[model samples]
Target: MNFEKIVQERYATKTFDGKSIPQSEVEKLLEIIRYASSSFNIQPWIIKIIPDKETKDKLSPASFDQPQIKSCSHLLVFCANKNVSENIDKLEKLMIANGSDPEKAREYTNMMRDFEKGMTDEKKLAWAQRQTYIALGNAINGAKSLGFDSCPMEGFDSDAYAKILNLSSNIVPTVLCPIGYGTDKPKPKLRFPKEEVFM
Candidate 1:
């Protein structure tokens, strides 16, 4: 399907058919994130593709009693890794793989290192979280391209969720997107016009 069509048809579907999606389809969504753009090209996202009953139970309280947390085929706990820019080796390897010349690769690596130095704890985590959301948007749109539906959600207890997911304070949870086939058509779009919201 065309990208524009996918964007137009995509919505946060609330109800999902109680059926499982193929593992390959789920991986395809993650594959989109594996190449998602980030500041400094630092891939800071880690996703826990939750399908276990006990883990799902642990997320119940964190997700504010949302049924999709337990009902959907897959509950994706998207995390942003805090320390994603510590590796000079990996960054240089990627630069060379992308066909950068020796001098250009070294120059880009230096710029990334400098950027990392100026980033504070708060700034780093905030930047990481923003990248995770961008990946979430891509995953959702990619799911739509595959004829699946998703609900992007942040209405959850972050601290509690971190504990449930066995994640440290550095790697924070930002969004929960449940993917499955939709059971009901969503209500009509009711947003103000682009001119009103954009200006």
Candidate 2:
């Protein structure tokens, strides 16, 4: 598909078809995220997949009864790690795959860790969240490429999601992306004019 078409047609889907998202397709979407670019390649995003009806029900209330919560076929929760440097080895692997030599990979990886360590808690968490957004973009576009609809959400209660998934202190939920087929037409998306926002 042309890039412009992807951008123009990608809207936040609200009502989803009852059709379930295939596990394989979701996995492929995740694969897209795994290879997404991140700030300094710290790459600290984590994804939690909720497929059970019980779990979805628990999440629905947290989302303030957002219809997408219960209407979508699958729920994906992305969290940012407070201590992403713990995954140095994983980051190194990604760097190497992206064309870094072994020595360069090690040196750059240490630099990223040090940069993270120098940040205040709020800044570090914010940076981690920024990385997750990159991954989210990749996942959303990849899903659309394969003929799926998604609702990118941050309307849920993070604490509720953490408790529902039994996530640890270091991993905090950042965003939710529900993927499935759409049953209803997307209402026209309103936005500021490009010239007003761009410059």
Candidate 3:
């Protein structure tokens, strides 16, 4: 399907049929999410995929007992990785390994490091969380492109998620996305006109 159709047809799925998406398809969708844009290519996000019913059951209450949590085939927990300096170092190494000139890679990574130094911990987390949303955008759109359904949800307890998932302090849960075959139909699109949205 074309991009326009995918965007127009895709909706925040309210409920999903209890069906498992194929592992191969899930991986493909993940690749699409991985390619999401980030500032300076820092890519400060980690996604945790939950496939089992037991864990989803546990997470449902934390998600305000949302039906999507338990009904969807898989739940993707997007987290912001706050270890900005470490990621900058890793990116530099990756660049050199992929045939980038070592000197140029170091120069680029040094620039990123300098940028990272200016941000406080709070700012780093906020910035990383913003980047995580870009990936989440890809996930919802990619699900539709792959003929599945998805919901981007933030109506949850982040602290509870961090505790239940046993995530590290640096990996802050930013958002939730549940993907599967939608049992519910899409409602009409309620969006502002282009003229109203644009300045």
Across 58-174, the per-residue lDDT of candidate 2 in tens digits comes to 899999998888878788898998877777778788879888898989997888778877889899889889989998898777778878888889999999899989999889999
Q: After superposition, how far is residue 71 of candidate 1 from its true place, in Å?
A: 0.9
- TM per model? 0.91, 0.90, 0.99
What Cα-based lDDT does every candidate model obtain?
0.83, 0.85, 0.97
Provide the lowest-lDDT 10-residue window in model 1.
Answer: 82-91
Our model 2 lands, by Cα RMSD against the true structure, at 2.1
Candidate 3 local distance difference test against the native: 0.97
After superposition, the stretches of candidate 1 with alpha carbons farther than 4 Å from their true spots are 87-89, 97-99
RMSD of 1: 1.8
What does candidate 3 score on TM? 0.99
List the lowest-lDDT window of 10 residues for candidate 3. 83-92
Q: What is the C-alpha RMSD of each candidate to the true structure, in Å?
A: 1.8, 2.1, 0.6
Best by TM-score: 3
Ranking by lDDT: 3, 2, 1
